[model samples]
Target: MKNDSTPITKSRGPAEHEVRAQIVAAATEHFSHFGYEKTTVSDLARVIGYSKAYIYKFFESKQSIGEMICGNCLREIEAEVSAAIGQSDQPPEQLRRMFKACTEASLRLFFRDRKLYEIAASAATERWQTVIVYEANIQRLLREVLQAGRLSGDFERKTPLDETTMAIYLVMRPYLNPLLLQYSFDYTEDAPVQLSNLVLRSLSP
Candidate 1:
């Protein structure tokens, strides 16, 4: 336990940085096994061999730690989506691949660890910064694909880019949002392809 007299520095040393990393690692493992909502900073302190006050030095609250973990899971999904769409395929094919990849990546998270899924659910429900950034990135990726399609003269130029991107993102929202996704799981396999095809047709020149 850090004494009240201990002077907290404005900057973190390498040792302090390592301590932060350890706290995050321990929290992630604990949350994965026991779920995020059920765990408290006190619980983390007990498990991490640190005082609650000490953990507070690294993270102000449990949700702050949950945000980091949830952010990671969402970013991993985006990374997978980026990789899947990295091919030189036509814009139509690329878009289809994006949808499929997103569904796969999100499903991977749900099936990998339900406790982690619980974190995602809470994040999505509460509209955390991670969810905001993740959704924006998805829109940005959609905009890029739409731009490519239009440039190739394969998609209609009548619809504005912003409109098209938002429309497409809204269509894909259920697959992207963990909270909404749980209710729509049944459509995961066929929805991506069929929905992508439908979107492609709508965007056709």
Candidate 2:
């Protein structure tokens, strides 16, 4: 007599992408609330209903998660900058809108949660690759605007394209840097207009 037993298959959990998203989301919350340095893989795993090893399966390390969060932040800013740039045909106006969009986005994120801002700052300093890409993206946007301005005779080409791009980025540092904005005594209602006007004048033909 032959007795046969039914075969059992191991159950599959969430998809890899799903698990990664969940991990990133949970990590974002903890990092935003507790901070990057204080939050750990165990904390993320506990909140995510998984083991620390499971969390590691998705991210290589805590710094990787921080890089993901910072990358997401930069992606959002790029989207906003693209939208603002697309909405205007005039170079000066486009430049103004781009600057406003980027600064406002940064300020909104920084003001909404100081901890998140700190996390991003930390990631920017610790994750050199991410910072390099982020800076390159910003430079590309500035270069596009400056090129448009030069083509339209709105801005005089006083310096090389590369130099002008860096100069614009540096000039806008006060508005773009969250840490600097936090220390500004006059970052009130009139700050945007004042900064925009100053930048426009500097770029004027």
Candidate 3:
């Protein structure tokens, strides 16, 4: 007689997560090669060797996958910047390092998954109003850094801290924007150096 009471083996949670990750990897490649407007869910599904319905089970749609991919990129930036910000005792140095990390991280991570970058860049162009809202939040975070520096007497500016922060962001905009970097003169060697020099000079008492 068999032991009918034995429990059935469940699907491993790690395996499920691995599947989800593979789906994202495949989607990123498809989007990068073809760009957002030209890619289709079927393409992603085919590359991953999964049915469209199964892919939908992991993600509701292609846009949903794009959001996840972009969110992963942002999280990486946040983590690196947060660490650099925390490590320095000097406010000006912290600000300088943060900007450097932001620029480098954006370049490295943005190009890592090319298809996703193309898709996101195209979508952002068409939906800039929404993109501005996201950008505003990032600007606000930078404002807080400026406020801290002002309180520390590390930065002296006639304008409000928020305004100064916005100006700093505007200055860095072209260097930080991936699309702009592709067209602009290469600053790979000097962008961070020039940025730090400008910040240091502007903030000196």
Candidate 4:
């Protein structure tokens, strides 16, 4: 005799992409408020209405979530940099605008979300490769501006492009580094203008 047992169907969960997005979103909120060291997988899972195991399914660890958040913040800054560069026809003006935009974006993000700044600082130390790649990309953008200025006679090209790029990066480090701004609170207000002036002057023909 055939038994009348019904087959049990497992419930379908959120799509992998959806799950990852949700995890990132919840993690962003947690990281923004509580910081990387304080925020845990359990905290994120609780905020997202998921189990820690569920969060783990999407993110390997809390650090992974912090990395994702830092990546998002960097992308936003990159976009701002691109937009600032696009707004000007003159290379020197473009460089100034880019500096202003990037500095402002960094300051805004740092002040608005200190926890996010903590994540960035941690990423710079722990996720060195990722931070290096981002720094390279920014330098590339600066190199483009420098090259354009050289062609337009807006900047003196006595130094090599790579050298000039590195110099600019060094000179602008205080303005660009969130941790530095956090410590040098007095400089925070005047950094964009002061740093941009210094950079533009260094680039001038």
Top candidate (TM-score)? 1
- For every candidate, C-alpha RMSD to the true structure in Å: 7.7, 11.8, 10.5, 11.7
Highest lDDT scorer: 1
- The TM-score of predicted model 4 comes to 0.84
Among residues 3 or more apart in sequence or in different chains, the pairs in candidate 4 whose N, CA or C atoms overlap within 3 Å are none
Global lDDT of model 4? 0.73
Error of 2 at 92 (Å): 0.7
Deviation (Å) of 134 in candidate 3: 5.5
TM-score of 3: 0.75
TM-scores for all candidates: the values are 0.90, 0.85, 0.75, 0.84
Angstrom error of the Cα, residue 98, model 1: value is 0.6
How many backbone clashes does every candidate have?
A: 0, 0, 3, 0
Please give the CA lDDT of all the candidate structures: 0.81, 0.72, 0.67, 0.73
Among all windows of ten consecutive residues in candidate 2, which has the lowest summed lDDT? 1-10
User: lDDT, candidate 3, residue 37?
Assistant: 69
Candidate ordering by TM-score (highest first):
1, 2, 4, 3
